[model samples]
Target chain A: MAGIIMEIVQKGWPISRIKKFIYLGFLLVAAIFTVLYIVKTNPINYVSDKLPFTLGNEKPRFLFSIYGSGMNGGLSKPMDVTFVNDRIYITDTGNKRVQIFDRSGNSVGLFGKAGNKAGEFKFPYGITGDSEGLIYVSDMRNANISVFDRAGSFVKILADNKQLNKPGGLYISENRLYVSDIAESKVKVFDLNGKKLLEIGKAGRGKEELNSPNSVSVEGNRVYISDSGNDRVQVFDTEGKYINTLGFENNSKTSMFVNPRGIGVSGGRVFVASKVTSYVFALDQNGQKIFTLGGMGQEDENLALPNGMFIDEEGRIYIVDSANQRLVVYQN
Target chain B: MKLTRLSLILTLSLALVMAISTAAFAAQAIDSGPVKGDGRSDYAATPKNTTTTYPGGIYLEYDANGVAKDIHSNYQRNTDACASCHATHTAVGASLLQWANVTDTCNACHDGTITTTYDVVYGDFANGTRTYGGLFGGTTEGPNSLSKHNVGEVNIAAAPGGNSAGKADGFGSEWGKSFECSSCHTPHGQGRNFRILHPDVNGLATINRVKGETLTSPDNLVFSSLKAPWLYGRPYNSSNFSDSTHTAVYVNGVKQLTGFSIDYKTGKVTFTSPPTGTVTAWYVPSFKVTGDVANKLTANEKVTYKEGFNEFCGACHTDYAALTRGDGKRLTGVYQEAYRHAFGFNYSSGPNKKGLVFSNNAAKSMTNEFTCMTCHVAHGADQTWWTDWKTKSGWEGIVSGENAGSSALKRLPNMATCESCHEKGKGDYTY
Candidate 1:
């Protein structure tokens, strides 16, 4: 191949013309590097492989998955995931812990364990990292909310929360923490000090009521929940008003969402992670189906029993591809 | 300190390798399937309501593509225990119970006033956590009724964080009902327990058996499994209480602080919180559930005791779940061995203990492991939560008289309850 290239160069143009072409090639490479720098998240370890599930417009592009390859950080059944201050906090639940990562998919740090202590977590469920550099995790078995500083040092738990029953999904917005009480079927809003400011929803079959809600997310004043029991993502205002229902298929009874567990809201879209169906469903702000992200499989981008999800400021989606025991990232 | 240094060296090496690999594979554009979503602005809501035999009835609750739910097949096919409480043919009420309301349907079999076949007075529905007895299977009316749960016929409101459950004006009642059997018991059933309680850890659908999924086993934290209530026929029911330590600690935003280490020979933690801070108790990350002292329970057995039953009850009565009930970050709270006191296999009478325990053991069989039945009845009874015979403090229950309530002697409702197997302690006693 090198001899042929030399012959083609001799027959095609002079040495000076060839030098000009080489210069243009160098400029192209430089421009590509500049574009990468302009975009904050370019995926540290990128594999040029095709991801199965993506929207038709090629909006969501699959990035390198962080399944702890070489020394890239391993995860075991990570549940909920959150992004704050350019860091990813995942409830690396199977390890009875939490795993933190930087935007470039580097292992930043980790904390928690399997115990009934202040810093320990017995099955950490929903995890949220706030702008204040505080990380809050909902212990499913402990039935409490444990707060930790950015370094994962033990901060206080939510104060005297007799109302937090089977606390599952968590979110931090407007300096308040929103916790989904799986048993009580309500979203509890708490102040930064962990005092519950108010609650949203009741237990019923109504549109406004929730039955065993798991993950709760907030966009503006609207709160979205993976109403796992109801088999749909129920949207509501922060004040507990029923806004609309997302993922409502033609079959109103058993539509698209089989077991919606984790949810995320950003960039005019909603992403739902369901357990039984094992699909990360992307829906528009109006509760319309945008695209389904994954299916039940062991392949790359195919998710099995996905738990939690986080969308970065640049529209990059980080999924706790839970049962697959890996953290998957995608871009649009 | 040695292990910390080793880990630091290892981490740094790993980081260096990762950085090199990252540099090689850097700047690749994401390539995959089509761009997502239906961009249509107009959408219609066409409700698909199918016709079934039972009018206005929601039979086959929350069916997942005809997937057989876990609780549905927990028992044998012939043993249709659901018929014991609900009757589809001779229905008498909305929920199809034998009686018009839950308060009456439960009282008919519980109050001991109905028929001799099922004689037991659980007291009024509106009664709180206080107990009542002298009927069928409870503490007698005299002293045993010290502190019974109140489930009387009064208007019950939603508990804190409670939705419209068991409220008089909630699901089934408009004029307001009283203390109800449905308030605590999920009669439809979720587990082996007769009255399905709240926070049934087994109620969720586990990823271990999702349809068409390759994950044949459950991972810790059950990320793949989905948690639902009995109302949805939940399937994913498992905990993260594994035998492996797998504990990771971070302080001051760093993984494994530099100033802490564990002496392997002594199994003790040595820590000096540097300016960056350090983790506490990561040396013994978890209690060893294997070993002669731990009864050599298998992984499944260990989970039921260590993480299951306590969490089930903690769903509602959150305060009684933990040993210390400490809510402070500064304090260290430890969970006790729930089985040794309740349904576990280590409840033999201790030496130097009260004679009441000995006599009760002699009269009845105290060989059974601890369970909710060991100390309290399934329904409501006359025993307070903390008034049980053992100490409340964690790691302090082995020796008696350590805390204020450790030595208090209490009895279950039926004379045959705790008194049937455990005698009252005169002074300080151990279980």
Candidate 2:
């Protein structure tokens, strides 16, 4: 290449012409760089690569993936999911109802819809059951949390008005119900009855401030709130005493919760579902991470927007694979 | 000077000898395909190398077509325990560490890889100075500048520039600005299908913005690669102006002296000015272009100056002529006067008479370049900008002027520099 270039130069090209050629060369290089950069940004709809499902370094196994018909044809935006007695209850958010299925993926029953009346749900996003088989759903748009019996009977509504603006996630611990409110940016505590207890943290990015507080899960006397806007998790005691903060970084990967709408703390672990990364990170007792699971795919195991997660006493992991429109169960 | 026939013969002979010896030593031939579990040869860099063995090493074996033949890393294999080493850490620094000092732990094995005899060439190896290798290759620095891992100088504890404030506090010499063996090249072996450090280091495979390109998207836009947010001729004022640090200021035409970083909570911009010049309005740069004038960017746009609707400093530095003529040469004030940082210019809203501001002052604690890497780490198979062979740990070389930020910026160590520019809302805290 150098010899060929030397021969061309030996032909005695004019300096002006040579300078023009250099400018042309630069223009060509710039054109190439621009084209490369433009081609890099392919718009949405062109689905990116479906990264392999990896929990830490483990290939998410198929403990069992049951495929059976459902009552609503197929799940649509299954917002939040919970597991109890081999039964999986999912908050079909877009369907405006709750669908119950067994471990075998067989539909057991369905309840709730877009209504302000009792027993009905409007934008249901959170699901959790109590020891007495009492189901609690975060009726987000209604700004109230409704309770129903295992038989799908309306039990009660424990919140109303600005107090529970867009209640997204619910967890029952020590007879106290913790409700994660998105708009209000605080977790409204209440008793089994419709009586409000104490409100914790206003909306802001501080140790105590909650920004877009989406989900809550209580372990012992501690409640963990996903401070979505702050890109961190705020931990507080049952009495509203701020304990500590977790996942404090602006990076996309190291983030524990970015728009995290649902949380489940069980077996001394906290599972945070990040709406941005679409991964469920498991944290230990001290909020130390055990592992991060899930990826972006529509397949049964892959998560799209995992809004809610539930861990059974048996250590089985269940996720409401929201955008994928289905329920995913990860059994040990 | 032209080479004589004899000289050419001698050069050719030397080149041939060097190429032959380099090729022979480079190819530490191994069994075809990726290494196997516990297979010590598995740790040896293979041709189409895949599968590395480490505690919780996420392994993925891909065929020539790039389809995943197998994925035993991340979560499949029991060894996929990232939390084992990179535990749930939430300090103000880099989390995810089993032991403290990352370099000390990595050196236990890499120090043995380097072989030196009578004299040390790279650095003071005996005094604990050493170098590392590139991604995939066994040797430290390869012959070609491109082929080499480009790991920069490693500053050990004895070294002056040790990262004392790093995640590993006083544990040992921290991996400084320079790249190390484990920087991009995870010592535990690359389990990522795309070869990132963590699961989403670079980005997920499915996160494509265009066809064929796996790891490219708008979210991947690094601040360093793009033009700076040019806030051209916008109203700006601050409440915290004092006559101390900010000794000189000019609003529209009046001459004043005041400098203060805004604190939104108190609605004040704290600047120390001399006890003279009165506080006046200033023009802050726009954070994002809302109109065609602010956003109309084109190709080969000169970095220095341009005519209409461009981000050249010359646009506002009309005073550039006046200043240069008054003095004999260049002045740095060209940036401070024409360019601004804290004032609001984003589409959200600009600072008003209330003395509000939007700057990264809220996060004054952070360091490091706040460009793309501030929020994005390259080589993360799941969360980085793109995949390049050069992305092995710490091998990130100097940026080409074309690829640099508005000021031909080099990367900083922390996220503070970013806040110096991208802070949101008046004052430090947005609360």
Candidate 3:
């Protein structure tokens, strides 16, 4: 209620008659605002004051993060990290290698050096090791998905189907591999032997279309895709039929996402990592948002430009904080 | 005493000469407007002037000596329109924009429907507000409306072999970011124009940037000379084709539009033609704002409507703004709007649809002319233009392989981007 006029009056500088009139006007305005504020009881909200740790339904503690020691565990703009069996495979994208780690965050070894050869990589981005420990690394620059065996040995380059272009995100399940190419703006499905099965969608804003799809995750008969360019997360059937969406449109006091790029499924929860908003949105399997987490900051709990992530059996979430050049872990 | 008298006489004579020259210069600057010689005389044109151009909503304040200063030119004064949208302390988001970004802030007012306009509700501009109204008559900015400009920034850096070094840092520090309102508008009152177009900040001002820089900008895409009008603002067809005759026809399609052989930076135009053996491109420069006599700005007004709108946009899209074809070698001496995309066309009398088609220049100036906002959204438009393909059923589907690469696909029904408004059917687009 008391604004600039009140401050002027408190200063007590009776500079002129106009100042007196202004003070009187301020007092009248203040009285009106005071009554209005009482009636409304609506408090003004400050955005920066919102805590990073205060988002989402399930509060996950900021467990120790791995910034990489520039040795065995070194990372340069790591894109995605996935946990298979007892080992973790991280797409060290900028370094052009996949760094394997243990559940305790210690480095096991790394595979696939930087090159354009069959066993090598060109800007390796997404990494997902299947249940059989058959590792799949999508080379964004090379436009090919390379498969590796359980011991970090190169199995073969996916040449049976040469349709990959700017392969950014990958998700594999039921002997099928799903590749989301950012540049091509589509999700491609292929068999474990690298034969083309079905192409999912193309660049568009429509229900069946996608734009700059960054990550794809599968659970049962449903596949959740991060429609980054469209600012929403779309759900598709295992056969790639369009099934509703969950994102900025469904945003409310409970859940919302902006540039939802990294998508992961754990149990029945769908976790969305938004690069621009720097928030990880958590939703139920039915596309209903449960809680939200993280805010734009460099703090322990805060996330900056989270790209790819995975959830372990124990409900621990590992986020590839791309811009921060670190792997952040959060456990409920 | 004799020597003193001589010195006095000499001084009086010099003073008289100086006074006469100063008066002549001022007259040359003020009198020769469009009213005098088709907006190209000792002055340039009428519309290019700020006094009548800025109309009412300009942000300017005069000093004690009556010199006008743009409000946002100095932040310490706090006189500009910054607080109109942006709040420094209580702001959120990466840009510290009033809301999330320019799109949200602009949509607050221009969304057309105004139960709660920013000027009326949240802003200090307690006056009437203008709407950036959706081309299709929506109240909200409708960024998500049909197909709107994409303002969201992607975290991916520009890869190698891309068409550009990279797009400007649109969102925050990251280059290749998507649209920001700042990409076009300065937000704060700046330059000599009201739109706050940053590259061509120096509008018709003559003290500096006289003949507008002809070379391309350091950014490599835009040309600097695009800041001001070198010829008249209206369309002049300079083709080998013909239509109606002119008052005096020099070229077939074009009239004797006397912009050739003038220097707008120097505020001079020539009516003289080449001699029997003279070799000259006959490039005369005139302007719309400087040519107006009655609207001579009193130091505090913004440039008028359609004055430098094309030139300002041409600052970024240099090739589109070229008056010449073949790499600046040929002098078409006009904007050449026949085969290429057109801007500044008079559309006051056409089918006045709001968005999907030609409508009233709703958010544009009162001149009823079409500028960049007519077809494009400032923040960014839908990427459907880049990805949509025609299916065998004539509907949109995910195009693949050879068709996407080798074949030209038909446009299908989508949100109101260029296609929805252009036309329907294969190659039958009216637009």
Candidate 4:
């Protein structure tokens, strides 16, 4: 190689000309290398158009999402949601208030603030409402349940800390309110007058036991409890007897129920929010999964660490996308 | 013909250079694939919707592929847990936290509903065990009790050990101007440091974990390659190595403490004689605990304090921490007082008193070191027992009022922590 370069230099080529030719070759290689680096590391190459699930094709199609900061008619780490009188109520946990929104995902108003007063909440984890335009909120940090009028007035307090410790997920049905005592891992049933009716489940992993029960939903003679720590939902008769379990056997990588936080029952189907996976599962009464919705993402269809879920009579599912600070509404 | 030959050689060289450069850049740019247990392949490409119109701009750490990094314990690589505290597009707080403040974000799950295992508000785990760090709120001591860290206190104050001049390690400037949970603890896992403490706290000092070493010795004489000069012991989930101790040797899952001796400086474990069966020396490595390893740790897993805690805290409390002997008494311009508690020494070197609570029960021998956590709880103390003493002696009025008893954040009430070890005049209480 050296002899060939020397021969080229001697054949009608001066030393300076030969040097210029080599320098030009080096410059050409440098320019090519720079172009390749730019193309390889371009941000556009990393952008993916693929999504986890196709939108509008799923069983429960996502409609839209309502989001904002607490001051701007939005939510802050909203934990639970309830619908009554054509209005959506969200427990805006971060702001220590409950935000009210219209059925079309428009902000109506908000109530409660950060205080221990009758109209205030330290941390509201779960919420529910009755047909009489009355709203019930589980004040998690205060360890009590507070009731409010439809217009968002503080009416009274129900179920003191003595009966409940770290209360979560409120469900009202048939003139009775079911509260999940998260600290005690028991679901306490109370009448409309705040009288203790029946206490269900103990703190254990056994058949009738619950560990960190988050939500409770009652449909006719049946009740569903989201046994969160156990990663399963336990169903029981209205009389507080164990009926069956759901989503426990589906403990696979793709479909397992991990830290199931929110639950709703409607149209002979059970809707559950798996908190860690950020997926909402619609299961039949027989515990077979029909379809799963909402993997973790910031999109309208995606849910990030969803909590309380409410399936209205019309089968419209309202999920409190907690981490996303939004309420995602889905309908069949 | 000669010019054509030269051009050919140059072209070949350019092709080789391009191939090498492309390979190097691709290695750095390629995504390592989906994290284990993450089902979705599109997770890496999830775009962070940060807009100038949004208040408190998003502050999430993302990889080159725009995948949000996991920044919590329990599930190290579980990106799904990221949504539990962060809001990718609609973040209300700095750092993309779902809540407006750090305290509220932490309390979302630590408030007992999600998991009672870490109910910081109540200061107790699910098993009713008091956490080393005391409560942020909800103390049963009294209605007017001030027994908490005041995690989100509006009026921030300078830390006790803070120094305007700088930190002891000569790194930080103006230590303890502001304080939050992340000031001391890194939400993202910190190598193998206990409790995910930050590697550098407020620029006071850098806390580096000791690199671990593993050795298989046919003869139980010498095992080397341990990196760190100081062998810090950490509790393992396995029953055989449940105890937290330095340089442990195992034979068939049984710890061989009696037969082995370790040289701390040289990082060598010397056994008395050759033992039968497979012999292995295991030390905790300084690496991030992945999801696989974190899943194995039980909810009530013990956290044994290793070295570097004094420097971690001293980064903020500049004068309070004593990293060496007699340093607590060595007063400086910050605080001219020789009378302060000495720490960062092994318990056996001092009194070696009985009845003193060791951080870990299994390793309650001379190896247990006396540090800040020895007498003080990290967050705050709920010592109601001091009430009786304060009332009877009229000390409540002399001090800062009714809440004065709870100010120090001590583990025991009314100097009981000091009495437990010193036994001053209480001989009967000595075990």
Best model per DockQ:
4
Give native contacts recovered, as a fraction, per prediction.
0.08, 0.00, 0.00, 0.17
Better of 2 and 4 by lDDT: 4
Q: Which of 1 and 4 is the better model by TM-score?
A: 4
| Model 2 lDDT tens row, A159-219 | 7754665577788776678887766678888877767888889866556998667678776
Candidate 3 lDDT score at position B416: 26
Give one digit per residue, the lDDT tens place, for model 1 in B49-162: 234211111222332322123222211211222333355667665556543334433432233211111223432211112221212212222233333333444333332111
Provide DockQ values for all models, in the order shown.
0.04, 0.01, 0.01, 0.08
What ordering of candidates by lDDT runs from best to worst? 4, 3, 1, 2
RMSD of 3: 29.8
Candidate 3: misplaced stretches above 4 Å? A1-56, A72-74, A159-161, A248-255, B1-431
TM-score of 1: 0.43
Query: Quick one: RMSD of model 2?
Result: 34.2
Report how far off residue B253 is in candidate 2 (Å).
44
lDDT of 3 by residue, A1-332 (tens): 23533443444333465456668989997987797576542122112113332223434657888876557656766789888868878887666788887888888788888667776775677788776888888876566888889778988887422587568788887778998877667889988888889888886667788866878988667888887656678888989898878863333321244456778765456789866556676766556656656654557876655779887656688998865678899874
B53-129: candidate 2 lDDT, tens digit per residue: 33222333332221122112223211222322353443222534433334322321122211111001121121222
lDDT of 4 by residue, B341-383 (tens): 7766666644434323343222234356676677766776554
| Candidate 1 lDDT score at position A65 | 77
